[model samples]
Target: MKEIRLAARPVGWPTAETFEIAETPVPEPGPGQVLIRNVYMSVDPYMRGRMNDVKSYMPPFAVGEPLDGGAIGEVVTSHAENVPVGSYVVHSLGWREYSVADAARVRVVDPAAAPTLSAYLGLLGMTGLTAYVGLLDIAQFKEGDTVFVSGAAGAVGSVVGQIARLRGAKRVIGSAGSAEKTRHLIDDLGFDAAFNYKDAPVRDQLRAAAPDGVDVYFDNVGGDHLEAAISTLNKFGRIAMCGAIAQYNDVAPPAAPRNLASAIGKEINLRGFLVGNHSHRMPDFVAEVGGWLRSGRITARETIVDGLENAPEAFLGLLRGDNTGKMVVKLG
Candidate 1:
């Protein structure tokens, strides 16, 4: 089996030199375990946090260890009766050709139902779940509310905007890093307004896009984005602080928000969340998103890179806002 290991810790942006690929004998499954031949692996912004030595909700990846994230594959062999060989599953197996893990840790996926198994790693999996729980369960979004999402062209942000619209939001505004992505949000994803953060100050852009003020902010990129959201949020506004892609690689402390006073005066509720905290709601989220997909009320996009060896570059691209939606690497 071929796998990508952490060769070195990165500074600012990760490079190909940070990862090393190696091949080893494929291991057989043990009792209660299964061997998965990985088909696809996810590359997300949050993984950047795990590369650092800092304390976080999740542990940092050790050097010379296989870097793991969410992956989808077929069960090549199974010691557990419940998950038989040939069944498709998703698990945290990293950038590998195959993985051996306990059957209980993986979820079975029906390719016939979704067609592309990679979708399970993206829209129908953790990314979608994060958006769902953050907006509804945590943020308690209400109908007719104006919604704003940073990193709006990426996986979680895209889903958050669409779901808000499907739930009858009065208006949905999004901020991306490029004009092309901004157009995609408004023209393709049904956002009421979208802007490129590079075009103007985020606070100014947000003000223009949401002239009525934002009721719910699905914050994905922190730093200036969060500061802007804080300033523009209306009274009783809710913020689901999902990620801080901007400051992930900063060696120096990021600048503190100058508009925290707004949070106090507006009674804004800003909460940082991890998807794992909302795992109990997965079944309900899957059913709802599935229904929405089948009804043509929601859509998904993915940027796929072809080889496990390219995983590092793909991930770096994601951090630079090069991907329009979910970024995944197909293992071959």
Candidate 2:
């Protein structure tokens, strides 16, 4: 078995030198455990925070240990009663070709339920759940609301816009880094408007795209985007703070949203959320989002990098905004 481990904590952007690939004997599943051969592993913005040795909602990834996240695999060998051999499952042990985990920690996945096994790592899994909970639960999205999203071409943001539309948002606007992604939001994802933030100042772009003012903001990229959203939000607007990808790799303290005082005047609700905290809503989320997927009212897109050896490149690419939606490593 081969796994990638952190060789050093990155000060800014990580490079290949920060990662090490090592081969080791594969372990057998012990009692109440299962051995999994991972087929797809996800690389996300949040993983960058894990690389730093800091206290967070999730523990930091230790140096010289396998860096793990969402992974979809087949249970090649099982010692537990419920999780049978050959069944597909999703777990949190990724950044490796294979994994050994307690059966209690693995959830069996039905290939019949999703378009593909990798969907479990994206639209049908944590990625989708993040968007769903962020918009509806955290942001308290209401019908006819005008919504805005940052990083709107990425996995979670893409879904947030679509879901907002399905729920009858009056308008949905998005901000992306490139013209291509901005077009994707408008043409493919059905966002009412989208702009390339790099083309102009975020505040100007957002204000132009959302002339009526934004009722809700789903924030995936932070910094300027947050400040812009704060400036453009309507009175009593809500913000679902899902991630801060822009500042994740900063070597020094990143600039704060200078106009945060606007929140007080607007009486805006800005709440940061971790998807894990809203697990209680998973069943409802799945029922609603799953139907949308089946009816073709929503879509899941992924940018896949082949092979376990290229996982670090995929992670680095994700941080570079090189991918449109979910970024996954296809190991099978």
Candidate 3:
């Protein structure tokens, strides 16, 4: 078996030199454990924060330890009576070809629920859950609300836009880094309007897109985008601060949104959330989003990078805005 480990902590953006791949003997399953052959793994923006040796909601990846995220695998051997062999399970043990984990840590996923097992790592898994909770619960999205999302073409943002549209939001606007992504937002993802953030200032584009003002802001890219949303937010608006991918790899501290003061007078509610903190909502999320997915009201888009060796590159590509939706690394 092969596993990718962190070789060094990066100052800014990580490079090829930051990772080291090593081969090791596949371990046997112990009592109350399962041995898994990984099929797919997710490389998300949040993984960058885990690379640094700092305190966070989640622990940092150690220099010599194999990096792990979200992974789906087939159980090759199971000592636990509940987790039988050949069962497909989702676990937090990625960046490796195989994994040996206690059965308690793995959740059995139904591949039939979606198009593929990889869907569990993206749409039906953490990424999809993040969008569902952020929009519907945290933001208190209501019918006829005008919603704007930054990082609008990302895994979470793409789903957020579609859910907002399906839930009867009057208008859905998004901002992506490229014109092609912006086009994907409008033409494919059912976004009413989208703009290339690279082409012009976000405030001007958002102002033009939603002249009446936005009721909900799903923030994925936080710097100027947050400021832009704050400026255009209507009274009693809501902002779900899901992520700040814009400054994830920066060495310096990110600048606060310049126009955040507008949020006070506008009575805008801004809340930062972690999907792990809201596991209570998972059942409802799976039911609603699962129904939308099964009925074709929702779409699951992904950019798969073949092989475990390329997982680091795939993660870097995600940060660079090279992927359309969820970025997954195929191991099998």
Candidate 4:
């Protein structure tokens, strides 16, 4: 078996040298444990924060320790009655070819229930759940509201836009890093309008796209996008501060969102959230989003790299805005 471990903590952008793949013997399952042969692993933007040796919502990834994220695998061996061998499960022991974990820690998933086995790591997993909770709860989205999402073509952002549309939003707008992503939002994802943030000032683009004013903002890319949304927000507008990918790798603090004071006058309700804190909503999330997905009312997209050795490049590509939706690594 092989596992990828953190070689060093990065100063700014992480390079290939940041990770190292090492071979190790596979371990046996304990009395209450199962052994999983990983088939897929996820690489998300949030994993970047884990690289730093600082305190935050989640613990930091230690040097010399194998990095872990969302992963789905087949149970090759099991000692617990609830988990059977040959069943598939999702857990947090990625960056490795196989994993041994307590039976209570893994959730069995039926591959027949989803379009692909990897869907459990994205659409039916935390990625989809984040979008569901952020829009419906944190942002307090309602009928006929104008909604805008930054990083609108990525995993969570893409789902947020579609849900707002399906739930009776008056309009759905999004901002992406490239022309192709913007086009994906407008033409394929049912977005009312989308703009490439690289083309012009976000405030100008947002003002033109949403002249009537935005009633809800699902912020995935903070800084300029947050500032623009603040300027265009109608009074009592709601904001779900989901992420700030725009400043994830920055060595210095972000300097924009200079118009935060405008949020107060506009009565903007900004709330930051972590999906882990809202596990109570999973049943609701899976039911609703799962219906939309099964009925073809929503789309789940992913970018899969072929091997575990390339997971580091996958993470670097994700941070550079190279992947359009959920970025995951496919393993054998």
- Model 3 per-residue lDDT tens digits across residues 86-202: 999999999999999999999998777779989998889999999999998999999999999998899999999999999999999999999899889988999999999989888
Provide the clashing-pair count of each candidate structure: 0, 0, 0, 0
Model 2, residue pairs in steric clash: none
Q: Model 4: residues >4 Å from true position, as ranges? A: none
- Once superposed on the true structure, which residue ranges of model 3 sit more than 4 Å away at CA? none
The Cα local distance difference test for each model comes to 0.91, 0.92, 0.93, 0.93
- Measured with C-alpha atoms, the lDDT of residue 113 in candidate 3 is 71
**RMSD of candidates 1 onward, in order:** 0.9, 0.8, 0.9, 0.9
Q: Evaluate model 3: give its TM-score.
A: 0.98
1-332: candidate 1 lDDT, tens digit per residue: 78989899898778888889988899888899999999999998888988887798888998999999999999989999999999999999868999999999999988987848888988899999999999997788999999999999999999999999999999999999999999999889999999999988998999988889999999898899889888888999999989988888788988857788778889999998889988999989889899998787888889999999899899999989899989999989
- Residue pairs whose backbone atoms clash in candidate 3: none
- Which ten contiguous residues of candidate 4 have the minimum total lDDT? 257-266
Task: Write the residue-wise lDDT of candidate 2 on 1-332 in tens digits.
Answer: 89999999999999998899999889888999999999999998999999999999899999998899999999999999999899899999998988999999988889998998989999999999999999999999999999999998899999999999999999999988898998888889998999998898999989999889999999999899999999999999999999999999998877879999889889999999999989898899999999999999999788989999999999998998999988999995
What TM-score would each prediction reach against the true structure? Answer: 0.98, 0.99, 0.98, 0.98
